[model samples]
Target: MVWAGMCAAIDHLRTHKNGKLIIFEKGGGFGGTWRDNVFPGCCCDVYSNLYSFSFEQNPDWTHIYPNQEELLAYLTAVAQKYDLYKYVRFNTAVDEARWNENKKQWDVTVVVNGGKDSEYGSGYTVTSDFLISCVGQLNIPKYPHIAGSDSFEGKIMHSARWDWSYPLDGKNIAVVGTGATAAQIVPEVAKVADHLTVLQRAPAWVIPRHDSIISEWRKSLLRHVQPARQWFRAESMKARESFHEAVTQAESAKAKQMREITLAHMHKQLPDRPDLWKIFTPSYSPGCKRSVLSDDYYPTFLRDNVTLETRTISRITKKGILFQGQESETEFDLIVLATGFETFDYMHPLKVFGRNGRSLTEIWHGLPRAYKGVTIEDVPNFGMLFGPNTNLTHNSLILVIEAQSRYINALVDAVLDVKAHGKHLSLIPKLEVIESYNLDLQKTLKKTSFADPNCNSWWKNSEGIITNNWSGTAVDYQNLVSDVIWEDYEIEETDGSETFVLRRKASTHIGRVNEETHLSTSTLRSAFVKCRSFLNWFCYSWNSQVDTQYEQVLKLSSDSEYNKPSRRLET
Candidate 1:
């Protein structure tokens, strides 16, 4: 999808005569997370309405939860429709991105096909005005540090890298971790495997997932009357947003209702086994970790062929897994680790060097922090799509990604405007402003369920800091990025010599991008028309309005300045 978007962006720029856009992909394929996690039963947890891009709503989604292959296909289709394949350079990993203060461009180093032994090749670097890091959180798989792991004679594989060639049929499988991946894989494997012993260090609270194929007639209705679908999407998002609020807020009616529903569901599922229920039910409030939804997970436990071992495994012996209390070893033909990704180590595969020759790793040694989860204070001309604190426990990620795209595009426009006006440029967020924003975030997080000490989730770091998730609802984040507060940023002018723009108060016109004036009225109108083509490709109410307004603004070229206001559009 990133590749496709990049291609579309580049094509749009080319057609409209905007600016250049280059995309670099580390892997041989485009789909970010979809390309990586090929585990069995891996699918989206969020409803399809909330999960998909708001601009490109998929009316033909087979189920509420789409599997990896379907998602990959959808992304591919999106790319194909947008004609974005040309801009993407696959099998090339970015090694470093160094910001040149003098040149006002990023020197990005990339390692292409840098594989092991004879397969390895030389690396190269490229320079660009903007840098976008779309490397998702779940790209790198996390391996458990079990003793004598290598000593195991049986076939062992991480869930992310599921060896499809190896057969699991009639085999004794010891599946570790009862997280999202495990929940899906267990039921599927139980149908085939002779005996499946699932090692559960911690049990997740599973909710009913009534996933079914939507009727063709219903899909047709959705396609025809998109407003109805849009309404459904809005309501679903609103419900999720409300859920987020309930989780964050101390004691609310919604929160109480949620608790009751969860408990009721739990009781309904595991009526006979309260001991299992006790372990499964979280002590801390819901939304501590990413809330999982699954109807089949609990019923899968009832199967006589499967066993959920609550006892923690001490080590991996030569014969089999050794539990803390068990004398008899549970031997296995195959061991599958369903442990999740290494999220903290973002872009670990590629080396990125920013200002002062400092690596991103060095900058964020203990805790990763970003101003608005997109830009770092020192990292200039670089934007992160799924950056720190942007991960949602309750809402759709596509909304976050789209917001990021808009924000970054605005920054790009600012950069281009500066260049066109014969001015050198650099944009950096104010330290005090960033500190204040983070301080508020910390305060808000302190009042949330994630801050509960009883809950130890991957959302927090080793120091127990909530660095992954946003402190509030998605709307709060959207509001934060709604406008670029110029007072919160430092702009540098370097046409001849670098000079800092004088610090101003919270004024409306602070560091506003200069309006374009070279193009004729007809040419401007034509450009707007070309830009509107994207709207036709991905029709949404927001895009439709934006296109119409943009065309109108172009037609009234004399009043172009009115549209180039200091404040960003609320929509």
Candidate 2:
């Protein structure tokens, strides 16, 4: 699934399963990024089977990968099925959020309909017992800082904010940047545009998508047979899991194999054009930056109407783009800036103040850090989804979102349990907990291909610290946040009493997988689990006993005993 839309599912689950959740969506609809990014050929790289929630398996996928429209339809269906619209305030944007110490609530400032003059449309403040931030990283678009960008007389558009009203047929177009978004847009634009020029700073490693249509019979079988769907999802997830080594270790055998596979795919596509091959190949490792999965991106260059330009753009003129060394500029009818988003600006443009009036942005100082990518050290009663160090390069983010939603639900339960006794509560982790945690995390990240010095990427900060991705595999991160250690927090209650202490549950609520399980073992176990689920369905029982097993391992300690926090990084 697209990473931004997962928050809607989390909102649905929380309302039904946990608290009286209220959502503040900045748009008029449900789908987040899927609703915003409607560029040509916009689709997910992950397979359709594994891109959805485990409980909501879609049996109507037409292709192996679903496009933006289909994914948005799925999210809209989910919101309607769960009646989440009643709880959502549409066209509402959160401007600022501050903690009230006495009331133990969040005073949120919101603007309705951009503060227009409509009925009940204006800026106001609302109070809530708890606050959760689901504004994902990819929401804001990033534009290039080229000189004289305002002088362009023709139509200019960012890929994220495409203008559908503009015509593309029989027009001369120029597309800048060769990232994932550009990889998808170039092929579709090339089919209709009279002439297309692809401006690139550096080339990306390309691989075959191997996408195919799912037959009607197969879709029916998957819908009717419980085992068939489970097995399909498991197989797809297992294939994606193997890519962890290829993306993490630069010198590993898996990385070498990935480079060879990418090179072979590129060679087969552009076999006759030896000069273009050198222009397309990258000098860095395959996993140093995000790789492109396509069967059409390379072949688009073979068209007689297309040209690939690798020169640096000096400025934007009234006619077109101007290269650094050239005196003249090439003219175009339209300019498509396929530049990506501002990924590192977490919770930006929204001010947040914590305890003692501490600014969240100032605290981060351009390096956003959080414990387990969920909660900050000084931010009490506030939980953030898709926070720091939670992005993945090799797998779908739905897995991470599932784990984080469960963890946040646990924190909410703890706070509500205290309120049940007519008392107020606030909890924050010790400062040293995240400090030591990130220190060990960065130590492991330096050894991965993401931190390779050959290429720059959105995964790191200006200081070259990897502030976007997790240090280990998706499974490794799932294990780390499987359980919340209550003893690690500085819990406080009202009435000037210290008698409240939350009891640990025997097991967490989410499904569990063993840390040492291998690929072959997981494949075999999935078969048995699917068969069991199929049999239980016939018996009119819907128990996930074989699928959902929670791990419970926690030891309680006093505040003083938990002084020096030291938790070993698993994997």
Candidate 3:
């Protein structure tokens, strides 16, 4: 069901299907972003209960908001539990993937890094029936375009690639951004740095975080009581869903309330420092850029050793950074670039060719778009997880990933079904379907806060197109991808067949996309969301007989071949 978000959808597919699977990971281990981003104070903004897989809830979390180490540990444990490591090739990268039209398979070239028994850069080729790209958008660290950055003699570090061996006990440090990553790093760095200068390009909306350690009693209760954990998970989902309109609808009442709360949070944290308040207040709307959640970030500026620099940087000298009009360059022992990531770049450096050798990079043209944020029009038997328009601003992305997994599984099922009938078929989304879906998606995104034009963030591309975030709530996204509509795809049968056959599948969700402004239906929609599970259970209890009768009617109308006893049981 759609309600069971993050329930090992991919693992379910692996266990059920009898096929060879290989995972090529560039990193040393299983955790993707969590394994890479190990900067100080790197913790998740989402609550711990909701950030995890629904099927495997960990009751042993120390804090409500988990740090990078804890998250990595959790992911590693989950991987071990599922035995995913056996299928993974550590330190191996995908160099190129091309669709073979004749074989209807993907020819993938991979590079494996040197190990104890292997050479430095050995490469090989592998072929697969389907290829799924899980290389997320935020893997690449983005350094600022400052002149003479290479000339700097001081030690430099990026947040995504942190240097743990370097000591920061009393070093002069300069942080180069005020985004979410910088906010997390600045506070931790200020505790040990002799003098810390923060370079702020723009201020983000800051909010208070009520994080606390989970008590032993509470942990015991969670481990012993299954319903308690489920309830906590649901409550977390509900709370995040309530704030969906706040981010999507700028002029919404919830948005206004959110701004007030954020302002109050800043004032409360740095009460005596009204001068610093002006420097911290965002000129743009709350959701224009990402709104940061922290109780420690704002107060870190109040430290005697810290300085906030909001001037334009001209260049990087051998010693340190030079401001636009300042007389002298600021000297620092170490420089940390908390400059975020290249979020618009998805599956970069991995060249992919689809039908007719059409390049994926050329098709995207610096702006990536996908059919329902998973598949493309010409890319047959291929899919991506956490692709364009699949990021969430108000809730956990685990939910969205689960939904995409299910949707991909549905597509795979369709292909397998066709194969069971002794035929070869390629499933690709229709061009018209892609056009219609993205048209409505862009139209809806124009009115959201992500398109505020006053500020530019990673949520959009360089062209000011909002390509990262979804247009609706996480629940809305879950509903949109609940079922795959066969009519929206062009099923090309490579086998010599006189006519194409149609499959009759009952759809629980259809035409759920192309939604108008979510603000208009806020009240009615929220009520339905709150009571949906209960309502679904109640309806099923009362209508089981009627549903069975309806299924019998559908079976009677189907082809006699499909109506056989074995097919009926399978259906």
Task: Please name the candidate that would achieve the greatest lDDT relative to the true structure.
Answer: 2
Please, what is the TM-score per model? 0.84, 0.88, 0.86
> Which should have the higher TM-score, number 1 or number 2?
2
Summarize candidate 2's per-residue lDDT along 269-381 as a digit string, tens digits: 99877898899888887677898988899999999999999999889999898888998998999999898889887897788998877989877888899988888988888
After the best TM-score superposition of candidate 2, give how far the Cα of residue 391 lies from its true spot, in angstroms: 0.3
Ranking by lDDT: 2, 3, 1
Per-residue lDDT tens digits for candidate 3, residues 98-189, read: 99999877899998875841375488899877777888878889988889989999899999999999999899999998988998999999
Q: Given candidate 3, what's the lDDT at residue 382?
A: 85
**Per-residue lDDT of 1-571 in model 1, one digit per residue for the tens?**
3532443364336444534666777667667777677777788888776777666788888775788898888888877766566666677777778888778888888777635511655677788877777776776889989988999889999988889999988999989888778888888999899999998776665655656665565566568766546655654554455456546553655455556656677788878888877878777766676666777777777888898888888889778888898887778889999888888876677677776777878877767778898777777766777778888877777767666666766666666666776776777777687788778887878778788777677888867788888886566566567566665677766764433233333433212111113333344344435544532233343244334322221222323222244323233
Clashes of each: 1, 0, 0
lDDT of each model, Cα atoms only? 0.69, 0.77, 0.76
By the lDDT metric, which is better: model 2 or model 3? 2
RMSD of each: 10.5, 8.1, 10.8
Which one is best on TM-score?
Answer: 2
Ranking by TM-score: 2, 3, 1
State the weakest 10-residue window (summed lDDT) of model 3.
512-521
Model 1 worst lDDT run, 10 consecutive residues: 507-516
